[model samples]
Target: MSIPQFDWEACINLMLQAMQGAQLGLLRLLSWLHLARDIDGQPAWPFALRLSGEVLLIDHNVVRALVSALGCLVAALLLLALAVAWRRRRWLLLGLAVALVLLAPWPDQALLTTAATPTSFHTSPERFSAAGIVRGEQLYRQQCIACHGADGRGNTPLGLSLEVAPPNLSSGLLWRRFDGDLYWSLRHGKGGMPAFEASTSPADRWALLDYLKANAAGVGVTDTGSWPRPVALPDMALDCRASTVTRLDQWQGQRIRLVIGGTAPLPSEDPRLQSVLLGGQASGAVGAIACASHEATALRAIAILTGVPEERLAGTELLADRDGWLRARNSSGQWSQQDMLCRSPLASGSPVAQVAQVGGSGLDQLIAAMDEEPVRFIKGGFVH
Candidate 1:
């Protein structure tokens, strides 16, 4: 008799494939489990879709509760079945015990009791008026539908192209977020979601927020207002050259023109020019900073401050006004859409119409031109 040759490599590959398939099967089952209203503790809509990229729709608290409950149920049922089988002292009793174990509903019930915490925001009541919704719907059709879909389900081709698929607006998980938080996020722009502050007015932003909320879970707008308007939006700062922290509010009243930059050697003749253009005199601005610096600490700090993921920091130039509202943003195509900064403000009376890449004489000319306008922001240092 001849010994058969074994294909160990092929067997290993097949086993790996099987394991992967099993994981996918488990994911699909969990996705369905997440769809249950009781488990998530919110209306099921967007997050009700299948799991993607190994992420879970449910939060840690819910997952922990479900696992603990399932563990107890399995243990209890198994013990009861085994005890019955032993007491009966019969093989038929053992079979019945196995059947009872198989029929246990603990896992399903555990999944049902799991809770979810959705995103939240601070918003005003007046923003949810009937007129606001109408304007928001129009804006949705014009600007949002390309990615979010007609049904606000985020099923469009553009949505699929995002690193994180655009979440369904109707999803219970998404609804947990406050309208103000969403508005702020939309204003600053993060990842695939562009900064609409450049294109959408503050009131219109509120309108869109109202529209989305109304559509989600079929909720109606309320007449009472709660959240107060902010005194000033939060300021942002990043470490610049010479170890100084460049706060956006510092340039509040200046004619600043920030550019998406990288490290450049300073001119030996002017040591103050650490890659700065016009040296704060001609431009009436404090020069510039490299967008993607070697300063990881600065980058991380900006991420924490802005609530923007660290991954989106590269190749973005963020601009702001004296009052701390991000006035404009420019980007190089190196990073993903979600990482891009806000575009120029869309307010009709905004100073800058489009984000300009001015330098040298062009920067000097823009600064001189902007000098005619009254300064609305100031962190104080302005050179005569």
Candidate 2:
């Protein structure tokens, strides 16, 4: 058999488009399926991923089917548009509407096939930005949508048939690993993924990543698909009143250890962290604190504010996973668009009397941020 010409940039470009179409189709179907006459507010689209420990992990197949169907619809629409214009020698927007409504069911294989076989495929990654996301979408469909699935959920029949499930590029795991890992993976095709280093060019891989983005659902979800954009800050100043003392009431007696600050694996030399065992000495009631933030300068300030001993602070921040995750130590006082600054730990808190307020956020928005042996803190930046 004759070999088809292989162009890395072009194939990925087409794949991106196909994947994008799948995503759009999924969105449209979900939006349509959930549409209802609202008695008062917008219709509730019940497609949220549950975050309870007891809740079993499950797949949203309805959304997946919608994505697949939408991909077909997008193609069908293009064909209908072409057919209408071919006969009339003019644009026919009506075809788009008719194609959209055709997801009901169909024996019309020819018409459907016409839509499925997209004609305008771009190959060059550079051209993608210039030509537009439509080109990017095409590339995604060509190379990735087969394994990643239209929704980015790694649920396609082909992907599922593989021995190891393709990594959900949408998961936090991606952000945790450096981009080099992904590039290497794409080039090498770890495990079941066939290495395309010989075939898929560098430019195409980068472009595909750009279009793929970091999705939580691993299907065709986008950034906005999961988390709402931070509430647009008011143009003018703003104030938010929050309370850190609220959660502290629960951790009254728990000892807070000190985790130190370090840019690399070893965090010993980090100055801001000293040593103090809160309540360890029967006489002095103080605890250690974790200081990882740039400039442990804040730890000293915390020592003075909290009245914890300079010797009581230890230094080390421990977390099973910290990528794209957050941990809140103090969440009191009011903040505004103007005061969007992170809280000052050393600037406040009293340790001599031993009052602790600590909290953490999980890497996954779904997981509860863990509160382990509370990382103690003196007035100094943070001693572990």
Query: How do the predictions measure up, each by TM-score?
Result: 0.27, 0.26
TM-score of 1: 0.27
lDDT of 1 by residue, 1-384 (tens): 999765433333343344335534554564577742321122222232221111112243434443455565676567667776677655665565566456544334322211122212134445234355556768888988899886577888889989988877765433434343476666667568888867877778777875665454232111111101111222233345544545533444433333333343221222221222211222223433331133223343333223344466444444333333333333452222232222221112433333233334433323322332223221100000
lDDT of each: 0.41, 0.34
What candidate 2 gets wrong by more than 4 Å, as runs, is: 1-136, 214-384
Task: Point to the candidate with the largest lDDT.
Answer: 1
Per-residue lDDT of candidate 2, residues 203-278 (tens digit)? 7665554444412321311232212111100011111123122121122233222233222233222231121222
- State the displacement of the C-alpha of residue 10, model 2, in Å, after optimal TM-score superposition: 45
